[model samples]
Target chain A: MMLKYPNGKPYKPKNQTPEQVGTGKVKDFSFGNRGKTLEEEINETNEYYLSRQIAIVHKKPVPIQIVKVEYPKRSAAVIREAYFRTPSTTDYNGVWNGYYIDFEAKETESKTSFPLKNVHEHQITHMKNVVDQQGIAFTIVRFSKLDRYFFLPFSVLYESWCHMKKGGRKSIPLETFESKSYEIIPGYNPRIDYISIIKKFICNKEC
Target chain B: MMLKYPNGKPYKPKNQTPEQVGTGKVKDFSFGNRGKTLEEEINETNEYYLSRQIAIVHKKPVPIQIVKVEYPKRSAAVIREAYFRTPSTTDYNGVWNGYYIDFEAKETESKTSFPLKNVHEHQITHMKNVVDQQGIAFTIVRFSKLDRYFFLPFSVLYESWCHMKKGGRKSIPLETFESKSYEIIPGYNPRIDYISIIKKFICNKEC
Candidate 1:
């Protein structure tokens, strides 16, 4: 069965495994992926972090607009009708070493560019709010075709978003990601060691 | 219709408004409440803070486990079967001036004591984790019978939890909240001004 977004658009689940890049020279260091989705990898990494007492991050549960519910006697209450609501903020957020961390994760099939349409306007605004409140905000974008993951800071994404408003490029080119964002190498224990990258930039400087 | 918890117990929706305590000496400062629930009041307060760019706190959406959904040919998807899952963390968490704020809100009808059963063991562990990570963790308890609210710190709650584990009292006396926690008097515009209390404690010293 298929699910639909609030706008009646078919909700496309980005649960596909990473595709092998045909380039023979490129080294595949992401052996831990094991055909897992980006979300799954991140969850695994978060569990690893939590167990180690390093961080306390969690993916916010999917927002559902409950319409009708049935309460059967001697049983649990079952939701009979509900609809998906458009989230106004990012997907993942939590405290990390006394710093607020907020970010959204997306997996794109396009190898050349990451489309701005993947993020909603409210989420951009929400990220701006987080930044204004002195919280760390960013996006984790996985170029599935290339098996490459980039941690795009909110600043870079916001700049591109503003440029898009002025009729600029519809998407951020892969070259920009290569230049501006930090590449998160997939590993075995934590799966995706994105927090190491965050610590290097945030902890060493502002935090 | 009534809802049920994960344990098949009838889910109690604590949406009732505050009642009069019948004490002639008690001045009714909560003019803005307008018979609203503690959750609604806090949501309003968070909105006020967000509008003024003071803090970015939000009540997390109810965690629902989606079992079955149906998508119509030309309409929004409908959740056919879903159940409310036991949340493993606090209900509210967000960033406040770069500080990670995490807390749970509960209202008790009892006038003498607040029962510990209102909070789950997993939530206590989660709060401990947040505090260990240097994040600000607390609980907002509302005495509906007395129309009073208090911000109980995690340390105090943890102590009580440990004591209870040692076969101590199962409930926290109302006097403990009066002395140990900060009382949040309701007001207009923001309704429950809890962040001011947080700022006084956190910003003055550590922040």
Candidate 2:
């Protein structure tokens, strides 16, 4: 059954994974298929980091607008009606060391490029605002097909988004990202040790 | 209509007010009845701090689970079915000068004491976890009727909550707060300047 919005517009899920797409040239890292998705793995890694008192970061819970609820008991309340709220910013934000860190994580099957549509306008604006306030803003883009991850700065994402708006292209070329972005090699313990890269490259010098 | 939880137990909306009823000791502070709430005022204060590069703090958005939505072609999306999700932590958290700060803002009408029930179990647990991890955790209690504010540290809150569980009392006495807590005098620019107090007490020694 096709999902349609109240106004008859086709409903599109915000973050959908490209399932059937095969892996590309990028290296694939496994955190074990313990029924945990990439997002969940990243969340666990964040928890690990928090537990170690190494950094303070958290995934912002999905925003929902609740309308109706059914109270069956004192402890468990079941929601009867709800709708998703479009977030104004990325999925994750916190302070690491002395810098404010804001970022979103996305995985894609496309080998050649990363889609611009994956990054929402509101998220871009939010990142711009953070950068304007001198906060560190970036995205953790995972080319799942290639099993590769890159931390792309907000500045680069902003420029690419503008280009896309001007009818240039819908995706950022892989070559462009390779040169400008910091590549995050996955590890066994942390799964995605992107912050280590950040500490080595960004925070060490800037802070 | 009385609200009942899923377990068939009647759910009581927490009556959060000062413990000493009608003492008229706690002062009153207003954000002006201009449609903006205490949360918005705090958000504005955070923005001010961000602008000045003094501190980084934010109010986590209320979590909701959305089951349905409607998208009108020319208007904003309307949530059709939604329910409120229990938050696992305090309302606000961030870092300043390398010290992790986490807090919850609550308003009450009574004058003598703050109700222990004003806070949730999960929030208390989260605060305890933060404290265990060596992060600063506290609550910003605003006596709306009296227009007074106090920053009650997690250590004190945890102690009071434990006592309440042991059938000691349902609230924390105002006298106890007045003696142990830091009184935050409201101002025009930054509505609640708790960070300044933190700078004086916590950050100066640590950072």
Candidate 3:
């Protein structure tokens, strides 16, 4: 029952209950004290969009390459040996209103700025590729401490990440993000109504 | 070093070669084979499609929930513990020519029939959901031993599966598949060349 990474490092479960483990200083700024994680909220919103036939977006399942499986008599097959595979892209992707939508959802505790290290190189490259294909690529950044959310476009993120890499600031300032990114207010019905912003910013003009 | 399924079954790797797997005896009538596995061919085809700007498709990474990690001296992070997560849908999905395409790549060896078990219930449900939203959904079944391929629509597969579950034939006979499915001729460039058939069968009238 011991889950270890390929290098024998222990894996951390991100889905632990807030009560089971302290919130660890990350202040969630998004609406009420509802303990739902960002991913759970987005998943709920995706379900809402799907039910309405408004879009067909889904969170890509966590990727695990199964190396071994045991089929016991009259029971579900059990995986015995598995290794973690490095994913090449961000989590969520699908089509909406004839536009290919790709995004990564991230939560942060810092109230003043979002750290550049939170965005990986592979993700940036993925966003670039999607944008090159004329697809709408963005990231849903939730400042947990500030309870604020923003949809940052790929171009702006790429520029900021690149700048940070070359001796620039380690984090993107809140003022810059506020000015450049589309603010997404969280709600009960659809936790992250990002597509509406997409319709306003990317779809109406392009498609 | 032990992987256990959620149901407490020990994982074991199937010892059979790729040729020995699946229901290949049915017939050589599935798609995706140029002397390589479907995953490799799909990767190549995705690259080709990306280069040509014809589509934006990708294979979702295998989902692994990491439990423990060891950052050995910062150079490498060795995953010491991880568990495989059950994927809720098919492996590959994306958009092509404004149509949302979703499919699962499967290889079988039986020369007479394809077993109903290879396709999972959740995958069927996902495909149905996609079809309900007017998306193009199908499975790319490969008879690797015979080096033949076929594209079976979700509707046909669903009906056959339902029948199989209700005390009908346990496997889909080759004759039924051949008569209803579109044969995809494998090639060097695209490997599957499925879009051509899609154009012929699914999009020609619209155009």
After superposing candidate 2, which stretches have Cα over 4 Å from the reference? Answer: A2-31, A34-37, A50-56, A70-78, A95-99, A131-135, A155-171, A203-207, B2-31, B34-57, B65-84, B94-100, B128-136, B155-171, B188-190, B195-207
Candidate 1 residues lying further than 4 Å off, grouped into runs, are A4-32, A203-207, B4-32, B203-207
Q: Write down the worst ten-residue block by lDDT for model 2 chain A.
A: A18-27
Interface RMSD of 2: 8.5
Candidate 3's TM-score: 0.73
Give interface RMSD (Å), model 3.
6.3
Highest TM-score against the true fold, candidate: 1
| Per-model root-mean-square deviation over C-alphas | 8.6, 9.5, 7.8
Each prediction's interface RMSD?
Answer: 8.3, 8.5, 6.3
How does the DockQ of candidate 3 come out?
0.25
lDDT of 1: 0.81
Estimate every model's Cα lDDT from 0 to 1. Answer: 0.81, 0.70, 0.72
What tens digits encode model 2's per-residue C-alpha lDDT throughout A70-90? Answer: 656543355554444555567
- Supply DockQ values for each candidate: 0.41, 0.18, 0.25
- Highest DockQ: give the candidate number: 1
Candidate 2 lDDT at A112 equals 96
Give per-candidate clash totals.
0, 32, 57
